[model samples]
Each structure stands twice: as structure tokens, then as C-alpha cells.
Target: MSRWSSSLWIPIVAVAILIGSILTGGRADSDPQGRPVVVYAHPPCPPDLMRYFEEAFADFRQSHPEINLQVLHITGNYEDKIKVMFAGKVAPDVIFMYPTALPAWVELGALRPLNDLLGTNVADYFAAGVRT
Candidate 1:
């Protein structure tokens, strides 16, 4: 996909809960070198979990050949590190965020709503997702 279509978000974010929600703040469009880069930042995790994350992205790359997806593994003080990144105005396009931490990031204006792009109601998603 040339752009982040609503459908792609699901498979892209299936890594697990700590990789919970996606927050897009910087450099989602074409990069300075004129290439599209989408950075996915997350805290360090166990090897197997990290493997799952990679596998998902492998699928993502296959499906979206035009977008350059980069994964950033931040060690030590994940939340604080993310804050520093945001302070520098260099937040990753997709960051691993806890649902509780979401309120704070939302306040910091670090998230972009995809309800419109999704074209699906939240209720419908939870209803289906939970059963599966």
C-alpha cells in the first residue's frame, strides 16, 4: 500500500498488548531523502515475543512494499524515553503504548484518530475481535 490504509493497521499491530496501540506523531509521510518511512518503536521484550513482532512486520512488508517500516527497540525507562523522543519532536510513526498511558499521550497531542479512516465502529471491532 502506498499509504496507511485502515485495513493495514490491524495486521501491523498484532504483535501483542505491550505493543498495544499505535501512536503516530512524526515522519509518516515521505522522509527527507524522499522515501516513505514508518518507524515502529517499542520497549525491549523476550526473544520469542520479539520474534512474533518481526513475523508480523514481515507480513506487513510483503503486503505494503512501498512503505519502509523500521522497528526501534528502546531499552530502559520506556515511557520516559518516549517522552524525550516526543520532546525532540522526533516521535516514531508507530509507538508501543499502554492503554492507560494513552490518556497522557492524548493530552500531549501525540495520537491521531483513525476512526474515520477505519470506517468501522469501535463496538463492532471489539465484538468481533473478542470472539476470535
Candidate 2:
């Protein structure tokens, strides 16, 4: 065919392939589960507690093999971590916090309100505790 016809065919074929790929959901990682879910815990959370969390998550993975859980320890300045994350628009899905920080997080709107999930009478929680 003519050079112009050949050139035109190349572009047409490229466009067709591009559109076909888009229609077919293109290429993706083999795992549909996506990135591992992250849970943040305050630094110095006692090795035992950390071990427990890991063990519990391992059990969870055994039953629900699709999801992968990652636990991150905040070594220093937990507040700074939260601040940076909020500013960067990258926030952890879950956090294990000591009770002292809870009020501040609530004021900052950093913590999701669990009132709906927990129902009322949250005051019924322990009057005092190690974490509280």
C-alpha cells in the first residue's frame, strides 16, 4: 500500500489497541485484593501487645486469605505522624491509641466517631484502665 496508507493504518491500529485494552480493563496486578491494609500502633506498645496483634492478624489471614494486614509502629511523635498524614492526604485505616490522646483526636476530627457503631452509653466504658 502507499506510504500515507501505511502510516494511517499504524495510528488506527494503535488507537484500536488502546481502546480495546481500556475496554478489557487493561493490565492489572494479578491480585485483586490490592494493597495491604495498614494499622498503626503507638510506638513502645510493649512487645507482648505487638505480638498479640500480629498473631490475631495471622489468624484472620488464615480465614480470609485475600486481605493482607500491615502493622506500623509510631516510634516517635505520634501526633506528628497523624498531622503529616492528614496534610499529605494519606491516613492510616486504623490506629491503636492510648486513652490520653483520644480527646485530642476527637477534637481534631481525626478519629471516626464510633458512637453510631458502639451505640449509646459509651460512658459505661471502664472508669479507668491501663490504656484509658
Candidate 3:
């Protein structure tokens, strides 16, 4: 089995959130080489959830101001979007997805490993919220 097939979605989300946070001004100072991070969300999130998410993203940006971020809204099948994104090599630096979809991505090496970022015990993450 390949290394990526070992299940490492945490790093993907971490990188995505990190990149998202940076672009939104979470970190005040950053290097010029930092690349812009793109974020995608299914359109029509509940208004209350959208408000909460905006606040959360705002908090994240405040901590990483140096990174750039773009939030794209999608209106079609989530899997289809993911398929095209990966196939076209335009996958976002981070994405929020259902747990069932991860194994396939792991097998495809479509995500980065969290071991290098959060170290071991990454699996200790709670199943609620981000872990799912």
C-alpha cells in the first residue's frame, strides 16, 4: 500500500484552514512567497451557519494575515466538483467533506499528510466538527 493510502485527511483540512486563515489576515506578517489559498463551499448553507462560519473564518484570518484566501461557492454535486477539481489538478488547498469520501482520496494521494504538521496522535481528533 502507498503512504498516502494510510488515511491522512487532517493535514489536508489543516493546510486548507491554515491557508484560508492566512489570506484572511489571521497572521499579520508573512513572506512574499506565500501562495493564495482557495476555499470551496456548497452554496445555500443555512443563514445561521453561514454567519457562524463567517465569524470563525474571521477569527482564523485574524491569526494568519499573511496568507491569501478565496471562498468559492458551488451549486452542483459535491463529488462531481471534487472529481473535476482533482482531475484538473485544481483542488483547493483545503476542503470540507463527508467522512465516506476520504478513503478514495487517500488512495489517490490527493491530500497531504498531517504527520509532518501535527505529528502523531492526529487520529485523536474528535469525530465531531472537523474530523468528520
- A best-first ranking of the candidates according to their lDDT comes to 1, 3, 2
Is 1 or 3 the stronger prediction by TM-score? 1
For model 2, residues 89-112, the per-residue Cα lDDT tens digits are 455667767777778887777876
Candidate models: Cα lDDT each: 0.76, 0.65, 0.66
TM-score for all predictions?
0.65, 0.52, 0.57
All-Cα superposition RMSD per candidate: 15.8, 11.1, 15.7
TM-score of 2: 0.52
Worst 10 residues of 3 by lDDT: 22-31
lDDT of 3 by residue, 1-132 (tens): 567765587788899986776566543232466655546544447778789877877887787676655566666676678767776555666777677888988888887765455557666665453343
- Model 3 ranges off by over 4 Å: 1-44, 119-132
lDDT of 1 by residue, 1-132 (tens): 646697777776675422433334434567666669988898989998899988999999899888888889998899899887778677787899777787799899888775565565556676643332
Report residue 124 deviation for candidate 1 (angstroms).
Answer: 7.4
Clashing pairs in 2: none
106, model 2: CA deviation in Å? 0.9
Report the number of the highest-lDDT candidate.
Answer: 1
98, model 1: CA deviation in Å?
A: 1.4
